[model samples]
Target chain A: MSEDKNDSFLSRLKAAERRSGLKTEDDTKESADDKDGQSLATLALRAGTEMISALIVGVCIGWGLDKWLHTRAIFLIIFALLGGGAGVLNVWRLVKPPPV
Target chain B: MAGGSSIDVLGQFELHSVFGGLGDALHFSQSPVYMMLAVVLVLAFLYFGMRPAAVVPGRFQAAAEVCYEFIRNMAIDTIGPEGASFFPFIFTLFFFILAGNYLGLLPFSYTFTSHIAVTFALAMMVFVLTVVVSLKVQGIRFFAHFMPAGASLALAPLLIPIEILSFLSRPVSLSIRLFANMVAGHVMFEIFASFVIMLAGFGVVGDVFAIGPIAINVALVALELLVGVLQAYVFAILTCIYLREAVAH
Candidate 1:
């Protein structure tokens, strides 16, 4: 009885393996085609998010400094411009392909 | 289409206490409840799936192994040979976000990742780890990363702050990407679902028209599923990339 149970378990495992193997092979082929489309979408999203975030950070830093140093709009204006520049730089770096 | 009420799309993200008394007293909201649920589900999957350790492996076991191998390979591929040490961290991070995303797809479940707080915390952890690793590996030289190798001296005043701002924004960008994606997808789902309800109120013809929104919702769900996995993959891969930069000479 125990041996029979073991044999059944082994057969079930084999079946599972075969099923998964077939699924994975098909998945790899489909994903290869899908990768290009997906990466482009991801890149666009990444670029936009990075640029906005960098600008926000720069502005925040500038505003905080202006408040602390009791400067009027001097630091704020400078930092906002710097922040925008940083944001553009971030987008550029993000879209550029990595160095080989 | 006539006199339809405005849909409260953002209302779905409002926080409310779960488990009644206990949750109220502790100020514990649905977000943490779903986060804990995600953690438990991940643990259960790993435990139950690995329980049957057969040579050929059963379906559950195979799934568990595949998850393990996927993260393992990703770490190595992105972070190089040293990636082995960080596999467990990346694995946990990937599955946690994935579970949160998938769980949110259920009828009434809250998506913890939709909250910027949670994603920011996760991103901050990654940022802190990268900083620590860079400092540990490069020591004082880590500061040199603020300035490019061949930059002119005159540009230092302009470039250093820009570089620093970009560096500081990593966590912000990382958190916003996931949070925005989750929020946008969920809001779209809500808007479409509300359309189905609103259209159904118009009678038989309206009910027939409701099919349009329903069909769009079905497609949206499918797209959201793809987005969930893709976001998780992106997060993990980005973490690996950061780690790779940290450890590199």
Candidate 2:
């Protein structure tokens, strides 16, 4: 009985292995190489947060610098723009098309 | 939720002392209690599950081995050969978060992962570890990554700040993602549960209508289960990705 169970388990494992191999084989080489289980919804969720967090950090730094320097809004203005750029850069990195 | 018409969805997240007056005196809350429980649970699982150490393996051993192999393969595959060195850290992190998430699904359990403070602390640790690893592996050259390979020298003033800001955002985004996902799932669960309670208050017809929300809540629980595991997987994979970049030098 135990032998039968082991044989069944082994066969099921082999079947699973074959299925996964086929799934990976069907993907493009680049995706297969770097695939880390990110689905579309996950990427979407990540991209939104990536952009916003960078902007938040940039604005915080800018605001702190302005306070330290006793400047009105010079540093704030500059850093906000920089932060916005950083946010775009982050989103770009996340959603950019895979390499050819 | 005691009062009619007040949803009180967010109240589920409130942290209060447990274990009677001792907890109040110590300022200890359910958060730490749950965290300790998660830690003990993970430890007990591995210890008891693997105590037999049979060659053929029992059902409990198989479960333990599957968890081990999943994290082991993920770390090695994502971070290359150097991943072996970081496997223990990654394994602990994955299992801890996984445990906390799964534990939260149980009625009356608090989820530490849902707290911004807890998630931020975890993310900051990962961020600091990656930075340390990069500095150790690549030395002075680690700073070079802030500037892209082909950027003009004149553009450094603009580009460097953006790059630095982008890097600084990593921990913030990582923390927010996990916290937000956990909080959102739990809040939705509570809101739907509230609907069932609220609807049943209206009488027999209301009781029949209340079944709708109950059905939805059941579905939401299933969704929450998937989200809990998926969020844990995302956190682990992102950690591996960051470590890969750090160790790539």
**Which candidate's DockQ is highest?**
2
What is the lDDT for B79 in model 1?
A: 94
Q: What's the TM-score of each model vs. the native?
A: 0.88, 0.88
**CAPRI verdict (incorrect, acceptable, medium, high) for model 2:** medium
DockQ of 1: 0.63
Q: Candidate 1, residues B140-177: lDDT per residue as tens digits?
A: 99999989889999999999989888888889999999
Q: Fraction of native Cα contacts kept in each candidate?
A: 0.80, 0.85
In model 2, the clashing pairs are none
Cα lDDT tens digits for candidate 2, B145-173: 99999989999999999999999999999
Model 2's TM-score against the true structure:
0.88
**Model 1 segments more than 4 A misplaced:** A1-35, B1-4
Interface RMSD of 1: 0.7
Alpha carbon lDDT at B225, candidate 1: 97
* Tens digit of per-residue lDDT, candidate 2, span A48-93: 9998898888889989999999998888888888888998999999
DockQ of each: 0.63, 0.70
